[model samples]
Target chain A: MKLKILKSYLNESIQHVSKAISSRTTIPILSGIKLDASPNGLTLTASDTDISIQSFIPAETDGKQIIQLSEKGSIVLPAKFFVEIIRKLPAEDVEIEVRPPFQATLRSGTSEIQMVGLDPEEYPHLPKVEERKVISIASDLLKTMIRQTSFAVSTSETTPILTGVLWTLTNNELKLVSCDRHRLAQRETPMETVGEQQFGNIVISGKTLNELNKILPDQNTLVDIVVSDNQVLFKLDNLLFYSRILDGTYPDTSKLIPQNFQTELVLNTKQLVDSIDRAYLLSREDKTNIVKLVMQDQGSVEISSSSTELGKVTETIPVSRVSGDLLRISFNSKYMLDALKVIDSEQIHLGFTGSMSPIIIQPEGDTKILQLILPYRTTN
Target chain B: MKLKILKSYLNESIQHVSKAISSRTTIPILSGIKLDASPNGLTLTASDTDISIQSFIPAETDGKQIIQLSEKGSIVLPAKFFVEIIRKLPAEDVEIEVRPPFQATLRSGTSEIQMVGLDPEEYPHLPKVEERKVISIASDLLKTMIRQTSFAVSTSETTPILTGVLWTLTNNELKLVSCDRHRLAQRETPMETVGEQQFGNIVISGKTLNELNKILPDQNTLVDIVVSDNQVLFKLDNLLFYSRILDGTYPDTSKLIPQNFQTELVLNTKQLVDSIDRAYLLSREDKTNIVKLVMQDQGSVEISSSSTELGKVTETIPVSRVSGDLLRISFNSKYMLDALKVIDSEQIHLGFTGSMSPIIIQPEGDTKILQLILPYRTTN
Candidate 1:
């Protein structure tokens, strides 16, 4: 294989695919990025047995010759070194020549690097998918949904299913749910489907979702998503991301969500979040990071936290309305803070059941985003 | 003790003193910051046995009332917690009231914190010095000198003295030298001294110098530095830093630097540094991170490194002139790159004694800074 590609174009494509390459992967081949030079352009791919990423650089872009391909073939190069070399290469064009005996030579200006390349046949191929059974969503919406709920996914691999965010599609509505047992975050968005098919309980690892978010741009254009029995594929522009699904069944979490509220208070999200954050400084010395909220009948919410060893803090935030009865509740301030970060709306409604029950936080205008937290019980 | 200080004013002073407090210190009192409130102003001090920092916030600054003192007393609060609390407090004015039995209350608007304060007598007192010997220099230049040579100090405390940078002042010139017996960096500057006292040998820990760099502002203003029998003090503005001097004689490194060169080359400091940095990607895998430079009298200088397991990289950098003989040498690329970083000049002169001897890298225009690197012998 022989190809000459513009340094800038190749560097950009290599960066996108390099995210899937793990330096310490048990599989040695997985640490290398697969490069295929064809007439269309050059395709770079990297995978770690869990998630795979493939990015394509066209032969020409904006009247500039990006790639010149000769004798199309494929080879795997060390992902980390290849990317670093491309970024630091002094010249504008990088020439890659692969000899038949598994030797690849990369040259830019006066610098030449000869690396031992692995046979492309030994590398895993991109997962194939059935096209018709796919859903489409705007890239911006998908990124938002992942960012909103993915943080709640359990990082511990003890329960593998909990490490992934559950993606469900029902009645053209895509729902994303993530929970670490102590707290839960759920987001829903409108999705378009070509065929009338209901999809539910597809577990995608939070790690892969985070990597996908970095690769996806902020454009509002629609992107295709194909979910196979064992793999899920996200197709955007000229890039494709394929991730293997977690094999276990996700626990049903619908019953844990509260359907009604005992007391509801609406206030500016930023003010409420800041007030709780200020209260968090005192509670941080404790293990639970518990901060208390007391709703008053006079439309005021008093935030307070105390550490027996450290000090105590109390702040009052005026609320628009506080009905039902005066109530006080406490919850982990970190969980509440994380939930507040994803709420984009200016106003947010917080629903409290009791001092010991789970409190719900959601944007006032939409039911699509919801955050639940189990309150800490304190003997006042 | 009762006082009201502006949040920002107190926060700034607290930050400077907090640098000396470490929670992991063996002495429990060292983890607390002592606050002394008098009719003059408020003083905050923190110490960790090795270094002590104190900053005073006057009752008024720029003719504005910043700190209102009602009563005069002293108390010590947890440094880390107090800093965070004051930083996040919402109100502009923070009222601090210390009651009997070492209980302090911090109130800002509706937020109130009651923390357990420690007795000020438990905290160590600042060392008193006789106003006999002192030296003054630009704070910015002193900071730069610390940055250039501190990285070369030995991190291991095995030798104890090698972990500190040696300061020698004589003939109105201050010289700083640091070496780990592998690489050495030396920087010299001119200063004014109060007495005709010659510094014999004083070693200050690199860790203390690093912290001082962070706290010291980068300005041309003069900083008063005084050294006693066992302590070094840096006085700037309203802050005072005192660190215990290492108790040992520093090794003489004068003979280690070569005075004459067998071959000399002047090149763009940035280009040579960048080339070595790129070459480091492959060199890092080797045990010594060895990269070879081959000087060609007829052509460019070749930079290459190879690992038996990984492949090899060969890059050439053009030079303006090459004298003496065609030389080949291998050295740790990281050390060379570090020396280049400290040069701070556009053009650098690399003076080589021989293939196995140390190479001196110095700025083209001045001899104020010098970096010496020992060459490594490559097995393969």
Candidate 2:
């Protein structure tokens, strides 16, 4: 491959693909980013079996030439060196030339890097994700949904399917759900679709979703997601992200939410968070993260946590409203804080069925988001 | 102890002293911060046996009442919980009351924390650093001096004294030197002395100096330094930092910088640094950091590094002046980069004694700072 490209564009594309190149990959060619230059443009592809990312830079963009191509070819260069050197290139334009037997030289200003490139033919081929059942969603909305739900994914390898967030689409609505043994988070949003399209049981690795989130555009552009039998593709502006779906079936979490609440209270989100945070500091000392909450009379609630050696912290804050039976419950304060942080509301409504039941929380008057945490059975 | 103190002021002092608290300390009492509240002010102190820090918040400062003292007493609270709780206290002013047997209750707004405090009597007492010699220097200048030399200190604990920076004050000048065997960085500046006062071989741990640098004021206000037999005390506006001097004689490093040179070159500091930086990235892959420098007869220098498996990177930049015979030298690129990064100059003068001799580098037309790096023996 022989081409002269703008350093800025080249650097951005390299970074986009570099995220898929894992340093721990056992395969030698998988540790590199494959580069292909042709009449269409320059495409950079990297993969580590589970996830593959490809970013492209056209020869010309908006009447301005971004690349001057002398020949069409393909080669795979080690991501480690290429990423760093391209970022520190001294000039505005960088020229890359590939000679016989997979040898490439990158020249910019007075600097020249002669790197031993791997044969691109030896690299793994990207999974062909046919555009089967494609659905479009706004980037910002998808990013928010991922943030709200992915944190609850199980990190244990014993339950492999639970390590991914389950995605379901039906009737132009998209929903994402993640649950560990202790806590569960669910976020649902409406997606605009021209036809009746539906897909379910699409479980994507939470770690891969985080990588996609990093490259997701901040703007309100549309992202098309294509779901196949076991492969999912997220198409962005000039970029393609492919994530493998977990093989096992995801557990049904619908029955986990309680249909009725014995006690519910509406409280200021930040105030409750701050009070729980103080109690959390003490609870963390014991490594139990057990903070107790008692629904008090006259629209008030008490939060407390104690360490056997560090003593106790207690605080009472006024709630906007309280209904049904009063109760005392204990739960993981860290999980509560995480749920409260992502709730985009000034007031949150918390519901409890009994002392040992899961605590249900959602933004006041909003049903689009739900977070639940199982209470710890403490022998008061 | 009973006192009502503004949360902001109390939080600031706690943070200042918390730097001295080490969580890994085997001693339980050393993990807590001692609080002494008197009619005059409230003092917070923390120590880890090696270094101690004290911060005082006056009862009133600039016509503002920061503390309202109800009684005078002292107690030690676990730094972990106290620091975090005070920071997230629910009100602007927090009231702390200590009962008999070191049980303390902190009240602010509607929050109450019952903490089991350690007896102040059991806390380690701060060493009295008698003022045998005192010198005043701008806080910014001292911070810069620490940053320039401390990076050269040995991180390995084998030679314990090499982990500290040696301080020498004589002839109305203060000099700081740090050497890790392979490289040495020295910084000096004239000090205003009323009398012929001098101190030498005051070696302070580089780690402690780094902690002290965090709290140093950014302004050009003068900071008082008191040196005693075994300790050094730094007095800031309202903070006192005490550092234990390393109890060993420092090696003589003055002769490492050669007075005469076989080849000399002067070049733009940024350009040379940039060229060397690119070479360092490639050299780092080999884990040897061995980058080669070749001086051209026509006032240009070539910087290159090669990996057996990854190939090579080469860059040449022009120098303003070149004298004597041209030479080729190789050294650890990381050490050279560190030495170059600390030099505060636009133009740097590099002097080479021979292929294997130490390379001397200093700012052009200045004798205040000198850096030396030992060259590596190479077959090619």
Candidate 3:
């Protein structure tokens, strides 16, 4: 491709596509990012086997010329070097020219870089998705949902499906759920959907969602999502992200939530987080990450953790409200801290059926989202 | 020890001493920070074999109570846990009490931590330095000298003495030098000395100096330094740093720098840095970190680097002045970048003796500091 493009525009698009270029790609051609220049603009694409990202730059943006094209052509440059070179280019405008035998030259101010480029035709084409079930959600809302639930996904690859967050659309509402055996996170929000259109059991890798979150707009804008049988596509303003869906049925988690609680407590979210965070410090030393919480007769909760070599940390925080049977529960403090951190509420409610059962936590006055952690069975 | 201390004061002191408590410390008692509380103040000390740092928090500072001593005693608490706990404590004031058998309880807000304290007597004492010949220098200047020279210290342990920066003081001039075979960095500044007080051959570990740099006052206050037979002591406002000097003699690098140049060029430091930085990126890809600089006939220099697999990057920068002889030299771009980054000058002069000799770099009009790098032999 022969074109002169603004450094800022090219740098932004390169950063977007670079996210899809994983170092683990075994195919040599897949390690490169493909560039296609046309009469309209320039398109940059980067992909591994699992996910692909493409960003487009128009000939002009907001009445300012961003690109001047001399010829329409295509070539693939190594993502690792190209990404860094563009960022460090010494001028506002960069001129890129491709010669025969796939050699590319990039010139910016006093710097010129000649790189060996690969044939764009050899790079794999992006998967085509049927746009029948296109759904749109606000970018910031989607980012928040990803942040809330994605951390709970199983990091282990043994059960690959469990490594993804399950996405389900029903009754004009979009819900996301992720569980990693020890803890589960779920979030739901209302959306305007076309008449009676509904789909479920679409699972996308938590890691992919995280990368997608980074590319999402910082401002509140809508992002359209298209789900195919085996692939999913997220279309933002000028960028497109495509990923393969996990091919397995997600476990039924509806029954995992306890319908009633024998014990319940409500406290300021920051105070509770502070109390448990201290316990987590000592718990992390023991390597079990176990922190214990016990209800007090004087309407307070005692949060504590002990290490065989380091002794113990005990935190006493008064509860705003308390009811049901007295109980003592132990759990992974790291998991709880992760869950509590995403909570936006000033106060949170905790529900427990018993010591060993799952403890349900919900933001105060918010019924659409919750987090659950399975308590550890401690002899004490 | 029983005391109520302001968390901010205690936290700052803890951070200063914590630098001496290395995780690699083999002695259990050395891993703990020794705390001595007296009517005057609370003293926090941490020591590894090579270095020891002590911070004293007075009972009152500037008419405000920083430490309220209830009883005078001493104890040693595990540095790893105490450092983190104090930082995350829930209150501005932290109360610490030591009971019989060396059990300590720390109370802050609603949080309480019970730690097993080691016997203070078991902790190794800090080295005693002879304070007969004490000289003082600006803390910021010492910090700057450390930053400029420390990075060149040999990281490899095969030559243990080379891991230290050599310090020489004579006629009110304090100079620091470090060399790791490939390149050498030297920085010198004049300080007021009392009656011919001079010391040379005092070498301190670069790692220890780095730790000291972190604890040095951000303001440009003077730090009294005492160089003893085997230890160097640095006295800050309320902090004391004692470091053991390397036993072996440091190699003389004075002869390595050329007294005259075959070719010389002067250019804007930032522009030269940017040009070479881009070349360094490509040089880094080749893993040799080799970037070549060639003097042009038309008052300019060319910076370039290449990889067999990735191609080449060339930058041509115009120089303001050129004199002596024409030359083409190659050196480690990373070393050049490190040396150039510490030059606080708008323009810098480059002096080259020949294609095979060391290239010297100095900030324009500054003779107090200089950097030297050996040229690499390359067939082109």
Candidate 4:
């Protein structure tokens, strides 16, 4: 394979795909990125069994020749070192030529590097999924959905299915749910799709979701998501991201969500978030990172945490209202903070059933997002 | 102790001294910052045995009222936790009150923290040096002197004295020298002093010098350097830094630096540095990080590195002249890069004796700084 590409454009494409390349995996071929040259453009593919990423640099970009294909072929090169070399090359243009017997030469101005390449055939092939059962969503909305709920997924391998955020799609709305038993985060967004076939639970790993989120540039571009029996694909303009779905049934979490609360309060989201964050610093090193929220007799919420070794901390934020026996509940401040970060409404409503019951938090104006935290019984 | 200090001013002073507090140190009391309140201001000090830093927050700064001290007393509090709490406090002014039994109350707006404090007498006192045998130099220049030579100090503790930079005052100049046997960096700057003593030498640990450098803050203010029999103190404004001097004598490195060379070339410092940086990437994983330079006959320098397992990289940089016969030399690229970073001049002069001799690099117009790197004898 022989090609000429602009250094900047080529470096960016290489870096985007390099995130999927495995550094210390058992499969040595997965550590390299596959380069394929064709009449249309040059495609780079990198994968680590769990997720595969493919980025294409078109032959022409904005009237500038990004990649010129002299000979069409494929070769796999070390992902990290190749990207670093391209970034540091002195010239604006880079020339890559792959010779027979697995040897590739990269040159830019006066700098030249000869690296041993692996046959592209040795690399694992990404599973190809038919596009019949596909749904489209705005890339920006998809990224937001992933970021809002993915953090709540359990990282433990004990229940492999819990490590992935479950995606449930109806005819018009797409729902994303993730929970780690202690807390739950759920987000729903509008989707444009044809046909009314129910796509049951497909647990896509949170790790792959995060990686795809970073690769998708923040824009309003639409992405087609195709789901097969065990593999899923996200297809963007000239990039394709594929991942294997966990093969287990996700636990039904609907029953755990509270249907009613004795008291509810609405307050400015940013103000409440800042107060909670400041209170968090006092108990960050504790095992559960628990902080107590006291519903005062007056219209104020008192946040407090105490450690036997380190002393106690107390902070207060004025709330809109208070009722129902002045309840005090303790929960992980980090989880609450994470939930607060994803809320979009200017005002947030928090509902409490009792001291030990799970609390519900939702953006005041949005019915699509819900956050639930299991409360810990606090004496004071 | 009782005082009220502006959040911004207190935060800065606490940060300046906290650099000397090591959270994982064996000495428990060393992890705390000693705080003293006086009628004039409040003082904060933290130390980790190797280095001690003390900074005073005066009653006023830049037309802003900072501290209001009502009582005079001292106590020690956990440095890391206290600094973080001060940084994130909600209010603009923080009120601190210490009561009997060593309990400190910190109040910032609606936030209140009650932390257990240690007796100030338990904290180790920094050695006080007399100001009579002191010299004054520009703080910026002193920082530069530390940066230029500190990286060359030996990190290995096999030779404890070599881990410190040797500081010598003579001929109205303050000279700093550091070497790890493979390379050496030296710099000298003029200073004003009162003592007529011809010579004095003190080896200050590189670690201590680095911590002191961070607190110096970019300024042209005069910094007083007081050298005593056991400790060295740096006083600038309301901040004082004390460091223990290494007991053993440092070897004389003056003779190791060549007085003359057979080949001399003047080149743009940035260009050479950039080329070396690019070439260094190819040899990063090698034990010696060896990169070779071949002075071509036709005003060009060839930089190359090869690995048996990995591939080979070669690049050439065009130069002004080639004085002597074609010469080849190899050395650690990291050492060369470190030396290049310390040079501030745009143009530099490189002097070489032969293929195996040490190479001397210095700025074109300044005799104050000189760097030497030992050549590696390569078989290739």
Instruction: Return the top candidate by DockQ.
Output: 3
**lDDT tens digits by residue: candidate 3, A301-341:** 99999988988999999999999999999999999999999
lDDT of 1 by residue, B68-163 (tens): 899999999988788888888778999999999799998887577788899998888898866567888889999999999999999887999999
Error of 4 at B45 (Å): 1.4
lDDT at A127 for candidate 1?
A: 82
DockQ of candidates 1 onward, in order?
0.69, 0.82, 0.88, 0.73
How many Å off is the CA of A301 in candidate 1? 2.2
Could you arrange the candidates by TM-score from highest to lowest?
A: 3, 2, 1, 4
Q: Which residues of candidate 3, in runs, are more than 4 Å off? A: none
**Interface RMSD (Å) of model 1?**
1.6
**Which prediction has more favorable lDDT, 1 or 4?**
1
| Best by the lDDT measure | 2
For model 2, the local distance difference test gives: 0.94
The residue pairs in collision within model 1 are none
Off-target runs (Cα >4 Å) in candidate 1 are A378-380
Clash pairs, candidate 4, are: none
In candidate 2, the residue pairs with backbone N, CA or C atoms under 3 Å apart (3 or more residues apart, or in different chains) clash, namely none
Fnat of model 3, as a fraction: 0.90
lDDT of 4 by residue, A1-380 (tens): 89998999888888889879777888888878999899889999999988998999899977877887899999998776787888988899989999997799999888888877898988878787987789887888899999999999998999889999998888677899999988999998777667774587988999899899888779898898998899999999889999998998999998988888888888788878877787687788466578988888788888888777667788888886555567778888988898999888888999888878888999886778999988876566
In CAPRI terms, model 2 is classed as: high
Better of 2 and 3 by lDDT: 2
Count clashing pairs, candidate 2.
Answer: 0
